[model samples]
Target: MWVERYGPKNIKDMVGNEETRISFLNWLKDWKKGSKPAILIGPPGTGKTTLVHLAADELGYNLIELNASDVRTKDKMTQKLGPTLSTHSLFNGKSLIFLDEVDGMYYRQDRGGIEFVQELIDSGRVPLVMAANIEDDKKVIKLIRKSKVFRFRRVVPRLVELYIEDILKKDVAKLSKESIRLIVREAKGDMRAAINTAQSLAGLSTEELSSVVSSRNLAYSLKESFEAFFNADSQEEAYKALIASKVPPRDKVKIAYLSVINSGLKGDTLIKALEKIGEADKIVNMIGTTQEWRLLRYLDRLLAYSLFNTLPKGSVSYSEEDMPWNLKVRMWNEGKVLKDIGGRLSKFLHISSREAVSIFMPYLLVVIGKEKKSLERFIRLLGLGESALKVMVKESERVFLKVR
Candidate 1:
């Protein structure tokens, strides 16, 4: 894969998040027994794990990396790591314990997983580092508060483009500026995805790009699959495009929704298109919850039908990098607050957390902001703390700004 083939050779070779990278390096350099563990929180392909490996190599610490999600139980994790955590010496080479995707450990399934990790941090024997792609989970928030949390923003598109260009140049691969732009835009700050897509298209010509559906690797790329679906001349072609896609059914629904919303369609057209997409999404979710794998057969046809004639050809493009990095940071910082609100609202209204955030929170915040009594009542009812109230106030302000 291009990802491994073009992997950073050293810490300096890594692109973007320069400040965080330096801070992380310094943390490793200065690490000692009893030093606080560090956690890297960010989206995928943002160099969190890669930074750890590179730092371990350059700093000469024996690297012991594990996926927390894979070690399902507290007992198992302890069995695997307890010995290392308790033993260290100058005679023995220094060791770094890196737990990747710590946030992915589900407490319900992996009982006391975070608690064991907490205990390891207290041991303070090894230089510990953890990374997570999400910050909103309650256990993850607990870890964040205890550890030295370093926030990583998504890599800017220009950097990703430049990096891809460098890789292509080194490999003697030729790609048009238009093709490169499409890959970068579709990659949406994921360097791994960008490189993988570039590798898939390395030798293809511009004419081949249009008919890339005939090629399985090209069809497997989510961006190309979406493009093929949107531009297909007939319903069968659109359905075939969806079938050829390697993207999961649930993700297909989500990408389709984002693509439609960002496509600049308006009035009834947009409304009707979203309605169909929503229908598909509901079915997808139902199939997941019920574990009715047979229902998946209808998914491609449904998605193809959802957008068919919904817009003129190529009007609805893929939209992955819609949110700005600054806004993304604000969202991450307030993630726990949002999760709290969603949890409370979901229980009170008997809706899912997703619905609580997407459907209720905005309007609820607006109403409470305008009416002091309602705000008081809601805070009391939801048991919302100052942090949640602060989030509510900020979100209400956003609503008002948009309204104005």
Candidate 2:
């Protein structure tokens, strides 16, 4: 959300954390592999995620990200990611592996998880990143010993004041020096928290600001996916977002193609969109096999399509909610289930997703009602109860009534 709003496309828009950001960028640019991963440790809301994404985004490197909850089992890490380490690059040259929140990973039943990840580091894939808050744990200290550690200090009040003043222009806060000092005091130098607190307080009257911070309730904004596809500041950022989205590259291409078409793109715009997706498909195909993992950089091209392929100016207005993430996730999962069903039937007949949809589905509908046992798992995954199944498949309220 902040990137779409406040992010600097280049180096100039950056506010604080100058020294660390610069050093990090320089390290990525100069990497020769075989080097240990780098760690960025900072307090919360200090743009640690943003910084990692920004660095990779600016550099055009593919990012494979893992967070704390990701299956960090010893067997899983070695068995799966083990090859990516020694094999090839995702993008022609090198790709970045980002393991955020590693400070929290120390000891467990799977004590070998951290040890195995270190083994991959020896294989020379490229740079790896780990981020955390308060690097006090013994495990974190051990990991820090293996990598260059960059500290992101809290943004000072004067720097925060400058940044906010530059953006908002007018004094939205309109506070006396005393109140400003109190806010600064309360902020503890985290500019992001301060900015957020200010945004929430802006809508409140003088009486409301005295109570508490309602702003800390802000959720991590969902705009990263959109910005990744629509207006990423850097090629690296765009590519990393697309890869991290976990949607297949082909589907990503298809979605972008449809978005452009839906935007009422025509003539040369239509021509360009088609060409872009065509190139996107080629890139996807190559990246799918290259193991060099280059399809990531091509994401910028996809995002460019989304950003420029909007409905022509004055042709259509826009709203904040194009579609909710929850709804999209559901439909996407449904589509996948449909694909799985289709794939099963396609294998039976030796054909494609299209063939299954066009031909096999009709047969299933007839036989499915009689022998509905096969559909139990899919129906459950779809969260469809007996009534929903009857309504959708049977079109018979009577069937539902009988079951009830």
Candidate 3:
């Protein structure tokens, strides 16, 4: 993999977070018994682990690294580090004890683990360095109170671009400026991910590039995924974030539409973003109606390339609270009504309920709008409830006017 093959070899070779790196190096160099342990906190792929590895190499300290998340219980942690707490290596050399993924350690799962670490710190037996993807965890908080904390920010875009350009120069790959921008923007300041993405795109044609970018193996939490999608600088960047997310396609579309509406976007930007989303919705509906799943491939491009220029960067963020409580309740009630109407129509028209909603409902509403008496006739024939009929009427008028 390019990430491994092209990984930074030394402290100076690493990108971004210069001051923190320097401070960490100084702490390692000035190490003594009774000194405070240090914690490196930042997002993933920002060189937290890499820094420690390089420091160990440069300083001649044998690194004894443990993943705190994996070493769940205190017993496991003790067994791993007990002998080496203040001792030399098998070679009788000094050692550095590094605990990584500290944020992933949970009190319940890693019972007594954080306390054991505290004990280690108080003992002040050896120089210790810890790394975490976030600092908000309770276990991490306990460590922070006693440790000197260093923060690492995401690598800047220009540095990432320069890094990749040098790599391409050596590898003799000829990717376009546009394709390189896609990889860089999509990486979102993750140096490791940037290298991996560039490796994936190194030899692909333009037609095949979209698939590679869309299918890139990125796993983000729902909130993270939505934020990345909405905050994307280009439509392609947003779409890549969307498709790369593990979110289900239907939920992805719903969230994308909801985010666009609530994002506070204005004027032509709002209109264009919504227009692209609407096109995506139509494509989603078409796939639902035809059961031709292959059409799903087009959604990424339709959303990304089409809306890239209009949706402002950092204009949208994902929050459950972004949606008003009243609107949510109304949507829930309306969904039940729509389900009832779809169910009745499914049986009446000998079609699936999904088809009834995705393909037939708009036309049915248009028909009822044109001929008022048809509403009563159809309601009786389909056994539609009064509440269902009211919803149907309201939806029909909305659909009718939209068509006009």
User: Residues 1-404, candidate 2, lDDT per residue (tens digit)?
Assistant: 43246544565566678898889888888887677778899887566777778778788876777777777778766665556566655436556888888876766844787886676556556688889887888778877888888899887778766665554444434643444545555566776666665565555666676444334222112233544445555555555555455445566666666555445556876676567677777778777787757557656556554434533433322224345446677667656655665665566678997798666666555545445565565456555566444433542233444545
Q: What TM-score should be assigned to candidate 2?
A: 0.46
Compose the digit string of candidate 1's lDDT tens values, residues 95-187.
Answer: 888899998888788888878888888878888899999899887898888889999988999999999989988998888787788788778
Total clashes for model 1: 0
- Residue 231, candidate 1: Cα error in Å is 22
Clashing residue pairs, candidate 2? 57-236, 57-237, 89-292, 90-292, 90-293, 90-294, 91-292, 91-293, 91-294
Location of the lowest summed lDDT over 10 successive residues in candidate 1: 210-219
Global local distance difference test of model 3: 0.81
The C-alpha stretches of model 2 lying farther than 4 A from their native spots are 1-4, 7-11, 75-83, 90-93, 109-111, 170-181, 210-404
Q: Give the winner by lDDT.
A: 1
* Candidate 3 stretches greater than 4 Å from native: 89-92, 203-207, 210-404
Report the CA-based lDDT of candidate 2 relative to the real structure.
0.63
Error of 3 at 208 (Å): 2.3
- What is candidate 1's TM-score against the reference? 0.57
Query: Would you list the rank order by TM-score, best first?
Result: 1, 3, 2
lDDT of 3 by residue, 1-404 (tens): 88887888889888899999999999999998789999999988889999999999999998988885475578998888877863543546778989898887778888898888888889877888889988878778888989999999999998888888888887888787766877788788999999998998886787798666555535565677778776776666677776676766677677777777776777988888888878888889989999999878877666667765566677876755547556778888989988887887888789999799889989878867566578877777888768777777788788988998
